[model samples]
Target: MTDWNGAALEKIAAAEELDLAPERPNGTLRDPVTMWMVRAGHRPYVRSVKGSDGPWYRGTQSR
Candidate 1:
C-alpha cells in the first residue's frame, strides 16, 4: 500500500469540502499535506541542486 498518512488526508479534505459560493471565498491555501509535514517537523524536500551540491561554490573546496 501507499505510505500516505490518513490524518493529513482528513485535513486537506476538510478544506476541499468547504462549500464556497459565488459571493464567497474559498479557503486556506495551506494544504494539509504541507501542514502535516510541518507539524511532523518535516521539511519540503529540495527539488534538485541548483548547481553542484559541492563545497566549491562556498569557497571551501576546489573543483
Candidate 2:
C-alpha cells in the first residue's frame, strides 16, 4: 500500500471547501462541475454529477 504525507493528508482532511476535477489528456481541466466530496479514513473521493455518462467522467476513464 502507498503511504501519504501527514501534512498533505491534513490539508485534505481540514478542507471545508474543495474544487476537484479530473484532468484531460491534453493537460487541461474539464469544465467546472460541482460534485460532493466524501472521505473514508485518509482518502478522499468525488463522484460524477452526470454519473458514468458524464463527459468528464468518461474522459477520465479513457486516460
Candidate 3:
C-alpha cells in the first residue's frame, strides 16, 4: 500500500471537519448530487448520499 505524507494527511483531516463533500474528478456536479465523506485513521471513504441504489453507487459496482 502507498503511504500518505503529513501534509496530505492533515489536509484530509481538515476536509473531514467540513460538511461539504468533494466531487468526483471525472463527474459533473449535477450528475451524482451530494456525496458523503469521512476519514478513518488516515484513509478516506465516500458513499452516495442517495444510498446503494444511487447512480454513483451503481457506477462503482460495475467497475
Candidate 4:
C-alpha cells in the first residue's frame, strides 16, 4: 500500500473534514459523505457521526 507523504499529511492535518466515497463490490464509488477528520501525530482518522450504523460507514464494510 502507498503511504502518505509528509506534505500530504500536513495538508490533511490542516483540514477539518474530508469527503469519503467507499467503493462497492461492483467497483463503483458510492455517494460522497462529508465527515470530520482528526489528526493524531502524523496519522489521520475519520468516523461517521452515526457510528457504524451510518450509511457511509456501512458502505466501507462492503469492500
* Cα lDDT of model 3 by residue, 1-63, tens digit: 566777877776665333433356576344435666676777766667778987767867777
Model 4, residue pairs in steric clash: none
- Best-to-worst ranking by lDDT: 4, 2, 3, 1
List model 1 lDDT by residue over 14-37, tens digit each: 442232222213443322121111
Q: Which model, 2 or 4, shows the larger lDDT?
A: 4
lDDT of 2 by residue, 1-63 (tens): 565577776777675545666666689976676655666776767677678997767777887
Off by over 4 Å in 1: 1-3, 17-63
Note the clash tally of each candidate.
0, 0, 0, 0
**Whole-model lDDT values for every prediction:** 0.30, 0.69, 0.63, 0.80
Tell me the TM-score of each prediction against the true structure.
Answer: 0.21, 0.60, 0.57, 0.74
CA shift of 10, model 2, Å: 5.6
The 10 consecutive residues of candidate 3 with the worst lDDT sum are 16-25
Select the stronger candidate by TM-score from 3 and 4: 4
Output the TM-score of candidate 2. Answer: 0.60
What 10-residue stretch in candidate 4 is worst by lDDT? Answer: 1-10
Q: Native-vs-model 1 lDDT?
A: 0.30
